[model samples]
Target: MSTVTLQEKKSYRIMGISLPLFGLITVGVLTATYMEVLPKGMIGAFALMMVLGLILNEVGNHLPIVKDYLGGGSIVIIFGSAALVTYNVLPESAVEIMSNFMRGEGFLDFYIAALITGSILGMNRELLIKASVRYLPAILGGVAVALGLVGLVGAIIGYGAKEAILYIGVPIMGGGMGAGAVPLAQIFGSSLGVDSGEMLSVMVPAVALGNAVAIVVAGLLDRLGKTKPNLTGNGELMELENKKAEAKEEVEEKEEKTAINFPMMGRGLLLAVSFFTLGSIIGKFLPQVHSYAWMIISVAVVKALNILPREYETGAFQWFQFVMTNLTGVLLIGIGVAFTNLQQVIDAFTIQYVLLVAVTIIGCVIGSGIIGKFVGFYPIESSITAGLCMANMGGTGDVAVLSASDRMKLMPFAQISSRIGGAFMLILASTLLRFFI
Candidate 1:
C-alpha cells in the first residue's frame, strides 16, 4: 500500500473528484434556470444555497467534509454559481427585482474599498527604505500629473458618453481606475431611475476581468525577470539585512513564550477591521476621491501615528489581500451575470474592447520599461518592474508581482524601485483622476 501525505490529499481535493461535484451542481442549476426549465423560485433557492455553501466551507475548515474542498475555491464556487444562475435564468423584470432587494440592503463597497486601500498603504513600507527623497518625489509627482490628466479626460467624456468613461478609464488607471467609478455609476443609475445594482454588476465584472488579466501579465513579466541576474541593488542588501535582524529577534521572542495567553488572531483581525472601517467612513465623505487611495492614505497616517503594531498576527496581511481581491472578483462576476444582457454580451463582443485592452496594456509595459531603463535597471529587471506598474498602478497585485519576480534574481533595488513606482501611482493617479474626470 502507498503512504498518503497531506500534500497529496490537498492535491486530490483540488483536482480528483470533489471539484467536479461543485462545478457541475453550480453550472447545471444555473444553466437549467437560464433555459427556463427550472422553477420560478430558482433564484431564491440558489441564494439560500449560497449561504449553505458558505456555511459548509467554514465547517469544512474545522472538520473534514470533502477533504480539501472547503478551502478558498469552495466558497467562490458557491457564490459564483448562484450568481450565474440568477443572471441567466431571470428576465429583466426578475433581475430588477433581485437587484433592487440587494441594493436596498446596502452594498459594503466602503469597507471593501477601505480594505483594498489599507493593503496598498501597507505595501509602501519597502519604498521608504529604498529611494532617495529627491527622485521618489519626482516620480510621485509624475503619477499625480498623470492621474489628474486622465481624470480630466474621464470627466469630459463622462458627461456625454458615460460607458466610455468607465470601461476605458478604470482598467487603465489600475483596474478600479477612478475614485468615482463605483460612486458615479451608482449616482447616475439612481438619478436616471435605473437600478444601481445593475450598473454595479457591470462594474464588478469589468474590475474582475481587469484583475485577472493583470495577474497573468504580472506572472509573465515575473517569468521573464528570472532569466536575468542583475535584479537587485545596494538598497536591497541593506533592507534584507534589516529583515534578517528582525526575524532573529522574532524567533527569540517566540522561544521565550512558555504560556499561550495572547489572543493573537483575534487582535490582528480586530485592528485590521477597525482601521478598514474608519478609513471607509472617511472615504464616503470625500467625494471624487478614490476610495482605495484615501484608505491607503488613512492607513499611512495611522501608521505614522504609531497606533498599531509594526506587524500583526501571522498571515494577517495575506488574508486581507486574498479576501479583498477574491471578494471583488466574485462580486464583479455576479454583477455582470445579473445585470448584463447575456445575448447582448455575446453581440457586444467586438474587436474594439480587445483593441482598447491591448493598447492599454502595451502602454503600461512601454511606459514602465522606459522609466526603469532611465533609472539604470537591467532589461529583464526593468521589464518586470515596468510590467508591475502597468498592471497594478501600485496595489497588492504590484506587491505580489514584485515579490515573486524579485526572488528569482534577488534584485532588491530593482524590486523596491518598482514597488515605489506602483505605490506612488496607485495612490496619486487613481485618487486624483476623480478631480479631473
Candidate 2:
C-alpha cells in the first residue's frame, strides 16, 4: 500500500505556522479575547496582533487589484486593523492592551532602534558618507516645493493660503503624528493664541490622509521604476559611478550567504538598544532635537569612523533582519490600532483639503526628484525617501512608505527625513505662525 511521506503530505502555512495550527491558535486567541481572559502584556498583544496581521496580510497580498496597486499586504494590515477598530469589531480591552504595548510600552521605538542601528552599521562606509551630504538638500527641496505649491493652490481655490500651508501643508510634511502634528499644533496654538487641542483636531487628519497618500504613491513609484528602469536603483538610493558601490553589493551578497548566528543577533540587540540609550541621553541635552535623530547621528558617526569591529556590524545587520522579517506585520498592526483614526481621515476628506494635500505631495515628488537627480541619486528613490517619507506620518509612516515602495533597505534615509526633516518643519511652522498670524 502507498504511504504518504512526511514531506509529501500537503500543508499550508501562515506566518510560519501550519494552516491548521494557525487556525487553532486564532480560535484560542478569539475565545480568550471574547471571554476577557486573554493574557495581559506582551503575550496577549503579540497573539492577537500576529493572528490578525497574518490573516490580513494573506488576503491583501492575494487580492489581484490590491496586490498590484494598493501596496499589497502592508497597507492591508495597517488599514484593515484600523477599520476593525473603527467599527468596534475588536473589543475595547484588546485595543487598549495592543495600544499600551505598542506606544505606551515602547514597541515602536524598539523596532526603529534595531532598524536604524543595524542599517547604518551594515552599510558601506563610503556610501554612507557620500549619501549623507547630499540627502539634506533633497529634503529641503521637497519641503520648499510641497509647502509652496499647496499655498498657491489654496489661494487659487479660496481656501486661504495661510490656512492651507499652516494646517494641511506643514503637518503633512512635518513627519508623523507624535513628532509632527502634535508639536506643530502646540507651536501654532501658542503663536496664534488658540487651544492646542483644537489645532490638533485640524492637523491630525491631514497627517493621516497624507500618510495614506504617501503609501499609495510609493507603490505607484515602484511600478514606475519597473516601467522605466533607469529612474530607480532598486534599493540603492544613489547612482554612484564607483567601484565602492559595486563592492557594497558584493558585501551584501556575502552577508546573505553567511549562516545565522544567534549569539551574534543577541549582541546586535544589545548594541542597538545601547545606541538608542545613548541617543536618549543626548536628546536630554538637546531638547529641541528628537532622540531618533540623535540615534541616527550617533550610529552614522560610528559607522563613518569605522569604530566597531566587522563582526559587530554583521551582528547588527542580522538582528535587524530578524526583527524586520518577524515583527514588521505585528508593528504595522500596532500602528493601525494605536495611531490611525479612520473616522478622522474620513472627516477630513473635503474637496479643498484633498486637493491641497494632493498638490503638496506632487510638489514633494517634483522637487525632490529634480534635486535628487542633480545630486547623483535615483529620482524615484530620492522622491520616495526625501519627499514621500517626509510627507508621511513619521516613523510608522516611514515603515509603511518604504514597504509600499519595496525598498526597506532605504530605512536609514527614511528615518532621517522623518526625524530631522520633521524637526526642521516644526521650526519653520513656529517662524511662519509669527509672520502669518
- The C-alpha lDDT values of all candidates are 0.42, 0.79
The candidate scoring highest on lDDT is 2
Clashes of each: 13, 3
TM-score for all models, in order of appearance:
0.54, 0.72
What C-alpha root-mean-square deviation, in Å, does candidate 1 show against the real structure? 9.4
Task: Give a tens-digit lDDT track for model 1, residues 1-437.
Answer: 99864434443242233544545655775565456454334354334334334434444345442222212233233334344554554455434433443344333453344344444334434344334432343333333333334344435544222343344434343324222234434444533457654554444433433434444565565565555435433213222444455443221112121222245434445655666567557768974544445555665555445545545523234445444543443333334434444443344345554444444444445544555445544434444444433344234334444554543333333334333343344454444344434
Model 1: worst 10 consecutive residues (lDDT sum): 249-258
Candidate 2 per-residue lDDT over residues 338-417, each given as its tens digit? 76666665676799998898889999998999898988789999999999999986666788789889999988788778
The residue pairs that clash in candidate 2, if any, are 175-394, 176-393, 176-394
Best by TM-score: 2
> Could you tell me the lDDT of residue 135 within candidate 2?
81
